[model samples]
Target: MSTRILISGASIAGPALAHWLGRYGFEVTVVELAPALRDGGQDVDFRGRTHLTVLERMGVLDELRALGTGGSPMTFVAADGRRMLHLPAEFAGGDVEVPRGELAQLLYRHSSARAEYVFGDSITALEETPSGVRVAFRYAAPREFDLVIGADGLHSNVRRLAFGPEERYVRHLGYYAATWRLPNDPGLPVGSVGLNVPGRLMSVGASHRDPGRAGAFALFASPELRYDRHDQAQQKALVRAAFAGLGWRVPQVLDSLDAAPELYFDSISRADVPAWSSGRIALVGDAACGATIGGMGTGTGVVAAYVLAGELARARGDHRAAFEGYERLLRGYAQGCQKGGDRTGPFLAPRTATGLRFRNAVLNRRWALDKMLELGKEVSSVELPHYEAELSGMAGREG
Candidate 1:
């Protein structure tokens, strides 16, 4: 019988892994906590050849290119609306940029035919038996699978259940970020424009698809905050307090918070697990090695999924060998890509006037900006083996 694999999380990494595993003839099943797919998020990009290579292997590279957002330039302004510094699109957009929600959907569609997806459910418990894993779900009856993997985000339930509490793994990086939709002002430009004060930033950009709508994004430096992840009202209050005395359209953006239908808020953090797997269970993507933002996390997630699935195919039924190989080949490379997250908070919202001035002055130089861009490509580069098992979907893939 083919191996029965259970994956938790229907986001990018989960679906991407399912696609490759299914193509390898594994019986793949994915469970997602959300009722359905999520949509309408900030732009996410892929950098370097490693990221592009995985997308090409999945056969979704052209599709993602069609959905690409031409990259958005950021303009930082003073309290009174005078532009201080401008960063071109490539700085943040990388090689190709797409909305976060859009990428999630594309991955889901690519894997749905090959994998069974159970939505609006979650894994409550897992037990490894002699030959497989006994899994319990919130809404479905208990079932067993040959292997289990967690592709959930940093706050992964699977990791918490298999590993210890989240405190042991997730470390806050002294910053918080939030985003929500707002009414378009019509006067707003194509990309992001924001007011920056010491330790805070309030930015907005009109939607590329719908000119009548806009997105509000804010970043602030804080030690560490405690709050309910599901409570939007409390999150809104925290954001309002963080920017209370700020000038330049601050009130206008805050006023829209009450009317915004959805809000995405979280601390800037990273997850570091000493071991990637235990017994019949393993982890991938943010659940394994991830940074909250500016970590090339999205790109890293897909690449890690590709390598994880390929390693399994190479090992066939020997999961221990597969997991060890996956970590061996990818850990150093993943950590190298993840280091960028450590600089995100200070870069977006400097803690002091001197730091802010230095950032603006230094990044203003074209040579400095070019040098930084070159480094991103360098860190994300990695060589990968072509897994072309006979009858595998990736068989006969173009070089």
Candidate 2:
């Protein structure tokens, strides 16, 4: 008999995992906390090597390419409100940009037919026996599955119950970031504008094939601030406090904060887990190692899903073997992305005014930017292995 797997979260990681798990012949069920498919947020790019490979294998590479945002150019503005230098869109985002929810929708479409999904609910508790795991949902009857995977985000309920406390695994990078969509203003242009004031950044860019709407990100350097991730009021107050004294159009941006519907605010953080799996329970994506919120996080999630589901198929439903194989194959990749996140924080938000000036100088100098791009090419390059099992019929297990 095929193993039955319950996956939490239907975002990028969960649905991607479901695609491979279902093909590998496991019965897959995904549960998401969102009432329906979330359809908003800033576009994400699938750059680096491994992420592209994952998309190709899933047969969504063409769709992703078609949906890419190539028209949005970016400009870095000085505190004095002058365009310092114009940068290609790839500078702030990546090689390509697609909305976060677009990626989620693409993943869901690929996996939906073969996998079952339960929306508007979430896992509340997980109790594992020698043979399998018994899961309790917030509003549904308990059910048993051979394996349970948490593709949930940083504050994963499954991770807390199966592993330990979140604080033990999450490391904050001393910064807070918020992203949301707002109405396009006549005052702003169609391209992106990045405003910087040493350890702070505010920007808005054209959002996913849409001209009348734009996505904005506000980031600032700060120590960890205590607030409920689910508390909208608390989050709003925090954003207001962070940018209270800023001048010019900054006030206008802050005013839009309270009214935006799809606001996503969280600490710039990474998850560091010693081991990603325990018995019949495991974690993937941000629940395992988010590697921060740039291009790398998206890529890491895609690659992890491929490697994990591939291992499960190879092990023929042996949870231990599959889990170990998954770790061995993907740990190095995760480490590389994590290192990029660590380096990026200092580069993106320099501590001192002098340091910020130095960074801007680097960006302004063509040779320095070229050198950095060369270094990035070296770090992002990886030899990906095509899972013969997935390409062929061997990986698909009949559920």
Candidate 3:
């Protein structure tokens, strides 16, 4: 029988991994906590040759290229509406940027026909037996799988269950970020215009496709605070408290939250797991090694999915060798990519006004912007082993 693989989380990593695993002849199943495919997330991007290569191999490169939202420009302004710093769309838009939601859908489409996808459900327990791993779900009958992978995000349930508590793996970097939708204020200009106060940033941009609605992305420096991840009211209260008494349309944006159905609020954080696997269960993407935001996570996750699936296919039934090879190949590159998350908080919402000014001043120069972009590429670089031969073998059998 073909290897049966169950992957948790239906976001970027899980779906992408499903595509590769299906291509390599694995019986794949994916479970997502969300009832439906999530939509309306911030634009995520992939950088450098390494990211592009994996995308091309997955055969979704052209589709993503077509869906690309060009590097959306962002302007930082004073409370009085004077532009302090203007960053070109390309500056933040890596090589290819698309709405995170759209990318997730595209991947799901590619693998849905071949893989069993259970929405609004999640894994509750895992037990490895001599035959396979016994798995229990929140609302489904228990089943056994040959292997399990956690592609969930930073707060991975599988990681917590398999590895340990989240405290041992995730490190908060003195900042919190929140984003939500609001009615587009015709009085204000379009595109992202942010107000940068000491330790706080509030930005809003109207959707290019839907001028009637806009999205607000906020960042603020803060020490770690305890909060329930699943409680929206508490999360909204935390955001309201964090950005209380802000000027320049912040109140209006916050007011809109009353009607907002969903909000993404979390501390900026990174995850570091000493190992990526435990017996029959393993981890991929952010669950294994992630730097929350601005850490090339989208690209790194895609690369890791490709490598992990390829390694497993190459190893046949020997999951131990496959898991080892996968971790060995990705750990250094993933850590290199993660370092960017450390700087993201300080860069976005500097603790002091002076720090904010310095960031603006340094980035204002053309050379400096170019240098930083170049450095971003270096961090994303990794040598990918050619798996085309393995793919060719699969095709030969089909022919």
Give the winner by lDDT: 1
Candidate 2, residues 205-232, lDDT tens digits: the string is 6555667777787788999999898887
Q: For model 3, give the 10-residue run with minimal summed lDDT.
A: 182-191
Among residues 3 or more apart in sequence or in different chains, the pairs in candidate 1 whose N, CA or C atoms overlap within 3 Å are none
Off by over 4 Å in 2: 380-385, 388-399
Evaluation by lDDT, superior candidate among 1 and 3 = 1
User: Which scores higher on TM-score, 2 or 3?
Assistant: 3
Q: Tell me, what's the RMSD of every candidate?
A: 2.7, 2.5, 1.8
lDDT-superior candidate, 1 or 2: 1
- List the global CA lDDT of all models: 0.89, 0.80, 0.88
Off by over 4 Å in 1: 389-399
Q: What C-alpha root-mean-square deviation, in Å, does candidate 3 show against the real structure? A: 1.8
Residue 385 shift from truth in candidate 3, angstroms: 2.3
How do the residues 1-399 of candidate 3 rate in per-residue lDDT, one tens digit apiece?
A: 339999999999999999988887899999999999988668899888899999998999999999987777899988887888988887788889888888999999999988999999999998889978999999999999999999999999999988999999999989999988888865455568898999999999987657888888989888899989989899999889988987887888889888887888888899999999999899999888888778888888999999999898877757999999999999999998999889988887789989988999999998998898777656557788777686677769989
Expressed as tens digits, the lDDT of each residue in 1-399 for candidate 1 is: 328999999888999999999888899999999899877567899988899998998899999999988888999999999988999887788889998888999999889999999999999999989989999999999999999999999999999998879999999999999999898975687779999999999999987777888899999999898899989999999999999988998889989999988899999999999999998899999999989898888999899999988888888758999999999999988998889999998998999999999999998898998897777567557788887643254445642
